[model samples]
Target: MTTTLITGANKGLGRETARRLIAAGHTVYVGSRDPEKGRRTAEELGARHVLVDVTDEDSVAAAAATIAAAHDGVLDVLVNNAGIEGRTADNGIVAPADETVDTLRPLFETNVFGTLRVTHAFLPLLNRSAAPVIVNVASGLASMALITDPEAPAGFYPGIAYPASKTAVNMLTVQYAKAFPNIRVNSVEPGFTKTDLNGNSGVQTVEEGAEIIVRMALLGPDGPTGGFFDAQGPVPW
Candidate 1:
């Protein structure tokens, strides 16, 4: 069976993606920072639980070890979905002038650095698979082509930290796909989904948000890598 792991799978887009992948016959590992929440969600979804706090080194290592042991050091797919949006406002920046290093550090810690840490930790297991795939959950706001347009809606958002970090994720995705041609890796924008990340103001639902993530996570060896896509199709980087 295809074995897949999704970070931050306890709730929202991650959880929904786990559900869909499980339905697709994948042996899904639901990863979350809290063991209690992770186990509960895994049980509910008939999946396994891996305690993975992407922001922490030890936790990510332990989660990797656990999955490696259970799956014989082979992971077919990995979904990097754990992320944090900076303190948000209704539609625009939250204290645009006050967005500083201190306010934005935590966002990068989880969204960018955390993704690098988790992906690095799981590379061994992923490499063992006959066909490996990595899905980096990104945002529409991260696209320079869209966000730079004065008439574009994504640019109107007042947040900088979240979008900037996701943009970093986009570049990282491209680089990883280039470095590991054997593995299918891509970045996916979930659009504005109704999740805690957006304070539930997103027009779409979690199920809707997880569409591209699941699609990218399950890509075959022939599928495109080093690209960014959304539910509608290719999203400009």
Candidate 2:
């Protein structure tokens, strides 16, 4: 059975993805910042639990060490699903430029830098697998072309910090995929889902949001790497 670890699996899209992967027979580790929440979510979903705070190096290392001990140091998939939607009053349009920067800084700490930290820590474990896969959970709003396009979906829901941070994540996915040819790395743009981030305004459900992520996580060795895809297909950079 493939061993997969998903960060921020206590709730939102992360939790939903974990549930789905468990059903598919993968040994999944539910990662969360809080031990109680992590353990509880894992128990609820019948999966293992690991405490992982992506923003902290010590926490991420500890989580990786735990996974190494459990699965004989072979990690099949690492889903960088933990992210934050910074304070965006009025969708951030009315906020000042400095406010945008201030808001985005926190989001980046988790969304962008946090992902790098976790990926770096677990890379050794991932390398042990015959076919390693890393899935970065991005958003359609991250697409510069789509966000800038008048007809694109992201153009309608404008949130500077959340959307821009996801853009960085999408780019990071490509760079990592190129860096690690043996590991199949891909970024997925989940369309607007009714997660806690969007104030539950999205039309899609969390199960729907996690579909692309779970699919990318389960890709075969021959699957496309260094690519960005939405639910339907390829997304413009």
Alpha-carbon RMSD of each model: 1.4, 1.6
- Give the candidate number with the greatest TM-score: 1
Model 1 ranges with Cα > 4 A deviation: 88-92
The TM-score measured for candidate 1 stands at: 0.97
Query: What digit string (tens of lDDT, one per residue) describes model 2 on residues 103-187?
Result: 6688899999999999999999999999999999988888888889888777785457778789999888999988999999999
Leading candidate by lDDT? 1
Per-candidate TM vs. native? 0.97, 0.95
lDDT of candidate 2 vs native? 0.89
- Per-residue lDDT of model 1, residues 1-237, tens digit only: 999999999999999999999999999999999999999999999999989999999999999999889889999999999998865455445566878899889999999999999999999999999999999999988999998888989878777788899999999999999999999999998988898876777899998889999998889999999999999899999
Residue ranges of candidate 2 with Cα displaced over 4 Å: 89-100
